[model samples]
Target: MKQFLILISFLFVYYSTAGIEQAPPNFKVRDKQAVFVDFRRAQYNITFDVQNHRALVETKILFEQKQKGYPLFDLVNRPLSVTIHDKEVEVSLIKTPGDASKLRMIEKELPKGIHQVIIHSEIENGTRFSTNDRKPDWGNVSSGFFIRDLRDRMFLEKYLPTNYEYDQYRMEIDVKVTGTKRWHSLFTNGEKTKVSENHYRVRYPDFYTASSLYFHLVPINRFVRYYLTYPSIDGRDIPVTIYSNYRFYNYLAKKKAWKVMRELEADYGAYPHDQLIIYGTGLRGGMEHAGATETSIVSLGHELFHFYFAKGVHPANGNSGWLDEALASWRDKGYQTVDLPFYDSANLAAHNLYTRKTDKRSYEYGRSFMGYLDKQLKEIGKPGLKDFLRVFFAKRKLTTVTTEDFKSDLEEYAQMSFQADFFQYIYGGHMPPESGHKHVDHDHGGEENPHHPARTEAEMLSIL
Candidate 1:
């Protein structure tokens, strides 16, 4: 027993210090005040016991502190133990700014240097196991499902120790499943490798943020998975995988996905991610993860188009979230151009500094602005908004962008001053009128969808 304990301690220490000398990727910090430390890499070893309904997670994060300050990492569940550079440290939960919940903040102040932090936690409420004859919506008899959709700041921090979306770092996850003999399959946006019968390892890119990862583990037989290789116009054979609990919709999903991919590739340059993963929920609407999506058959095209916009040129904050949704909704509406006078005030890109939720008006009001821009561009003998998007995606792939970044890029591309339009429509909450025409009131409400509940400022205020 003494030798076993020593071995475990040595292994933990070894993992904590591994690859500490390497330099982290040089990515610009979006919000420096919100995130103090620079995250280099994060590694997690998770063990899930289906029968016991337990999930044990061991995490090691390597980061660099440019200034002497206290570090903050968000985790909904408190850790059992936390060690900073092999020294045990105490942590406290404080109310996260602009969020309704709290985050775990380290109490000690550290010098400006690289540091290794280790955290151990057990997830009790995040995993749901099957009970009696009823199966959970996400889990089955021999498996458990873990999903982290970016709705109202629910990222990897819901189940793991993670930084915010402003920080991107390389991540590796080691998963082990126990109390089940059935084969389990892992679907994610990372590069996966099978280590053993029930042990799997996944490595995500160095540019992945907390919201960029899409992870799901389930029994192989629970869902029907369809795989195909799409020949891209950029001379790459992209692997596409679509899986769902219902098998009958898999064929139609694949066809729609193929058609959408072709359209997106023609608009954009190429598929930006390593692979395409789709979880067809056969529902009404969908949520877009980086390279993967949990979408309905009707919303498959819209979700897949996000890989080039939302996931490709990532938004750094809530204020910038309207760009991708507006672009996608415009594309979904057949890229219609309109010449109409705007009268309503709906500020979609003006939110608090710590806010992370996208505005609800991004669906209809933001889309109308896109159409208005398209008409303005065409009238000036320039290409439409689609052409500008193609150029924008080509230049800004795999990078974080803000509303100002989009405006500057567009101004540089079009060689015109859109400052007034952006200030009035996006930031100032008033749209500029076009010609002598009847003003349209877009402030009635956003398009109602049953699947996606409205997340307005009023709702957030209520939650707070």
Candidate 2:
């Protein structure tokens, strides 16, 4: 009997500690289970089995405001009563409903440093409503209501743990609904354990995080099936998906689309998430989510490039999200085509063309610049390029940057004014600078176009 007990105990220990090697790591503690959030009563009510930090808030918001089904994410004229750790605090609230939805509460006095906050506000139930297309016109484009409300967590600054910077935070979400379906598909971080027709729960480490907006996949549309792309750059079983309206594209040429992203991995490192995605959306552009990025299928390379640049590379040039879009577009070329000078000098010509189309969308320009930088990095030596990117992001902490910042940093590093013309070209959208132009090889430009055409995924294994 004693021997049997010992054997059982050993088995438990082995299994508990055994599976971690193949799984993603967890950095922060997350709350347990699929708990319900009930806001269908008088004032927004919140209750959770407190295992960690806790906050209780009472908000004075107009319950009769026009709700396009995304109220907490929509505009509000109501005041708030913030209660953190049982202490009532006053906070000023502001909301801007746009692509970059802004909701911030300015409070001058606090203990001054970091403090976990909780917010309780009356928000629209976000239930499905048949609109012009089940998507409201929030801006020039229209989208399913919840898509616009992605950053809604930041709407309540008085009692919620939200800010511009990324960090880990625990949340217990409870939204009351009157629908027949009690289960909703929740796409979150971590492994999928619980799955139902209505409820979906997943967990994640989330070292760096921003407020996210997501409902079940069905809220927008129905699922086709989870498809797979290359499992990894080395072709490991890195499964990526394309949630489409119809069947997943299976053309031999279509699978070739992932090659661009594979090259991107060589520089920034393999995809942070194995599941690179491009979901069908009504909007023309895409948004860079942490794991599964969403955009149109035809724009797959450009969209995936955003994940590599925005999520992988640190922001160097400050022009809102410009660094993200331009870098992605630039990276797409190498991934899409094996053409010459197109990988090198020809890329610069495209970049000059990109900048000429004033108001050509910010993200695309950022993609181009990122591509330019990658080619330049290869020319300057990998280690030097690594150092260049390091210096660029390190100097600009918590702020957007511009090529001017790089020019200044480079001038200091090279001990001369480097790429001054390039800086102006980036800012003024002028012709590519002679020195910074991707085609410029004034002195030592004779490196022989060094990209191989028949390099299979097997050969690419060396990069990872």
lDDT of 1 at 290: 80
For candidate 2, lDDT tens digit of each residue in 1-464? 64354345334333221111111111111221111011111122322111211213233211111111111211242334454444665554433211122333423233321122334543322222222333232101111212211122322232222332222222233322222222234343334444344333444322222323222323323445455657565556666655555454333213644675665566555565545545554334444554454444555566565454444432321122344444454544443221122222221221321111112333343344454444555554554433554455445422323334445666565454435334433434333332243322111111111110122323222111
Candidate-wise lDDT, in order: 0.70, 0.34
Q: How much lDDT does candidate 2 score? A: 0.34
For model 1, what is the alpha-carbon lDDT of residue 316? 69
Candidate 1: tens digits of C-alpha lDDT, residues 282-333: 5567667788987778878878888888888877665677888888888888
Q: Residue 322 in candidate 2 has what lDDT?
A: 42
Query: Each prediction's TM-score against the native?
Result: 0.83, 0.51
**Candidate 2 deviant stretches above 4 angstroms:** 1-81, 94-103, 106-108, 122-161, 165-179, 189-197, 211-221, 227-229, 234-236, 248-257, 266-268, 314-320, 332-423, 426-464
Best by TM-score: 1
